[model samples]
Target: MTATTVRAVLFDTFGTVVDWRSGIASAFDTVAARHSSRLDSVHLADAWRRRYAPSMQRITSGDRPYTDLDTLHRENLTSVLAEFELPFETSEADVYDLVHAWHELAPWPDSVPGLHALKAQYTIGPLSNGHTALLLEMAKSAGLPWDLIIGSDLTQAYKPDPAAYLRPAAILGLAPAEVMLVAAHNDDLRAARDSGLATAFVARPLEHGSDQSIDLEAESDWDVVADDIVHLAELLHPRLAR
Candidate 1:
């Protein structure tokens, strides 16, 4: 598909537009502070995120009915707390607060600016595994200027599932080829492409913290490969170039 054929640009919000690792780590620190315990917040963040895919795998594999991200996160929090062996007992309220942290993630430095730039021309919004409520809260918290949010709650499917990719395109009343999936994960882009959506790869080298090793570069020749969201805007909307 040509550049002009694309009408909407949908982003993978977690690592692509927001810094989940730092945001989650900071949230964990806040929780630990409330308990007056010094926990490895960074490691806790990693552990929590490590459970992300596996939690969804159950539903994606049809082993369980579809569950929203909030419930899955709350469930994963229980497992992570057990694995961490927190010194203090966490009440349900505390668990809910921790789960809510996912909705308070900070955007990448370039995210807001780049989104504004792209918004001048194309439709922009999150097409994420996050639930609609989570994505809406995150967009508001991070100053994300999205046209709309299409979360897993709406589609009832997660990434790598063809439904997740195609459903959003249909919801927007656009053909799959008219939509572009911008992501930091090569696998996600591959899924979008296989589902007939155009793809853009935005490298987020620090997404998994300083030790991140994967998705530092485009593994395949996507429609666009950018250093960051700002670069994505420049690549897609060339008139923004100085």
Candidate 2:
């Protein structure tokens, strides 16, 4: 939403702007069909996300050097296959296709339209952990018209890290307060706030699928809260609220 001081806004892409669960799960559709494999796509998708925290922690703890999400996703694909006792020796092409699923993510129903409305008033883009190439591909495929994409690969630091928020603002020639972070996850907003950036929390109840237990509602008194990105656009552009 538009704020008196906010000149631009950045979104947390995974859950906030796109549905990763369904996107990743559906990737297995091709995998199973092509390989005649019995794939539990939903379970595999969940299992892959379950590894997200640990994978990022490795970088955060200095146990592993910083890497792009594409690299992380590749390692995750191999790991999840092992975790699920699926055949890991499948064709490398299949592995690559599955790993590239991040580029095929579909935006929420409100995402494209809301982004259009917001972009008309304020500079809008995504600040996500996704690699630049992945974000670019998704934007092209999903019809998301972003001004630019910024995140971990740019700063070599992932979200919750102050760099993730601060570096982007600095790059934009903006003070932290001049840039707002719109995310469905509270921890993301908390980190943004802690970094001096404004925060907006939008509910993404099904982001993690049926078992989703987090970010079903706003957990903090963020600068704004809306049911979806479209509602967030309306809140920001009061003229459109009519």
Candidate 3:
């Protein structure tokens, strides 16, 4: 793709830009300490996260009506607590506040600097399954430096859907090829590629929690696959002397 043609870089948020599991686990540790002395923070965090995809699939497959990420998270949390037989009691307001922990996720060490470098040359933003409010809060909390936020709420469709990849390009007044979806997951890149957008993969090997098995390497030939986001920025913007 031509330099002028590539106007924006859209990113997958959770595993791509932020370490959601670690961030959430940290938050759970803090909250659980305040809520109950007996709480097993790591177990709670893991159980809740394990429910995320299935919750989203319920909406995606029409098994359940559409709900925002916060609501879905709360539903999962309730089930997880019940399954674990945690004795702590929580109000709806408490659950709501807890679910918002997702909005405050910490960016990976290279994320802010790399995104800043790329933003100097391209319109940078997120294209994620997160809700618009959640994305905005995440940006503010983590200093993500995005030009816009495109979430599933915008298209009512999730990633791997061609519309989800192409809609952002349309909204940015560019052709499909003019946008690049930068992600850590090969499946996300594959979807972007199939939708005619350029693809960049920045490896985040520890994304899937400690015993991560998938996405250890790129499975397909992406336009670019870098060791990390810093390398990705360098590839996207070469240093040219005056």
In model 3, the clashing pairs are none
Best by lDDT: 1
Best by TM-score: 1
- Across 1-242, the per-residue lDDT of candidate 2 in tens digits comes to 23878999899999889999999889987788787776889888888888887788888777888998888888988888776776535778888988899898999998988898888889999988887888999999999999988757888888788988999999999999999999999998999999999999888898987788877889879999999888888888787663
Residue-pair clash count for candidate 3: 0
Q: lDDT score of model 1?
A: 0.91
Which residues of candidate 1, in runs, are more than 4 Å off?
A: none
Superior candidate under lDDT, 1 versus 3: 1
Model 1 shows how many backbone clashes?
A: 0
The positional error of residue 185 in candidate 1, measured at the CA in angstroms, is: 0.3
TM-scores for every candidate against the unseen true structure: 0.98, 0.95, 0.92
Better of 1 and 3 by TM-score: 1
Better of 2 and 3 by TM-score: 2
Q: Can you write out model 1's per-residue Cα lDDT over 1-242, one digit (the tens) per residue? A: 67789999999999999999898888877877898887788899899999999999999999999999999998898889888788888887778888998999999999999999999989999989998999999989999999999889899999888999999999999999999999999999999999999999999999997888899899998999999888888898799653
Q: Model 2: how large is the Cα RMSD against the reference?
A: 1.6
Give lDDT: candidate 1, residue 241: 53
lDDT of 3 by residue, 1-242 (tens): 65566789889999889998887777766666767655666667778888988888777787876688888888899898678865667666667667888999999998898888888888999989898999999999999999889887887877676788888888888899999988998888988999999988888888876688889888898888888877887777676111
Name the lDDT value of residue 162 in candidate 1: 94
